[model samples]
Target: LIRGGRVELGDARDLPFTIKRSWARERLTPDVHPGGFVLGCNMTMHRDVAARIGYFDERFGAGGPLRSAEDTDYLVRAMLLGIAVEYVPDMTIFHHHGRRDRKAIEKLHRDYSLGNGGLCLKHVRH
Candidate 1:
């Protein structure tokens, strides 16, 4: 069985957060890894759980509207299918956290809206 989770990315000045496991869910407190859960870093090719889960929803892109909830959809579906999500704070990755200007923002909104709507149609219409 594969377990996965999500982590928050912080700025250089901010302390990176770690993933905390829910003690209540453990049958017996594990010694090897005290935390019953596992790691969840963003877009790491080697250890990313999505290789077992699947790829990003192509309906999402930088300038797309439906993009915001793509990750939420994946994580929710994984959980519903009984996949475990753990938070791993020790891992670090670099991401481009660029600020978009008004035009970029507008494009993203429109594209994401179209992409999300397209996803709904493709998945539900059949």
Candidate 2:
């Protein structure tokens, strides 16, 4: 992790800031929707769902102006559109963000905030 601890995407029980105690540690069921907190690195969807939702907004992700929240925005769109989402806790993978230096770490946080703000604006305007 950038700040020194493990970035446990599976179970965020150790994290104090999350509203849900278990975070991504949910049983595989349609009843459990990940909402906008879904991580892009660990998600799968059917092609039809992709077709229905189009693609992640280019203006909100890593290569775009916002530099984050593309996954969040995509899932937000899915949820808003009434798409059926299921969280599969059994399927997992490691995410190596590679932000080692202090500058990179700070930039990550900055970009995250900026992206989040932009996402909020976009949704609020709609």
Q: Which candidate ranks first by lDDT, i.e. highest?
A: 2
Candidate 2, which segments miss by more than 4 Å at Cα?
1-24, 27-36
lDDT of 2 by residue, 30-98 (tens): 344333344676667778788888878998877999998887777767767777455544454544555
lDDT of 2: 0.58
> Mind sharing the TM-score for model 1?
0.41
lDDT of each: 0.43, 0.58
Error of 1 at 37 (Å): 14
Clashes of each: 12, 0
Q: Which portions of model 1 show Cα errors greater than 4 Å?
A: 1-52, 61-65, 100-126
Please estimate how well model 1 matches the true structure, expressed as its whole-model Cα lDDT. 0.43
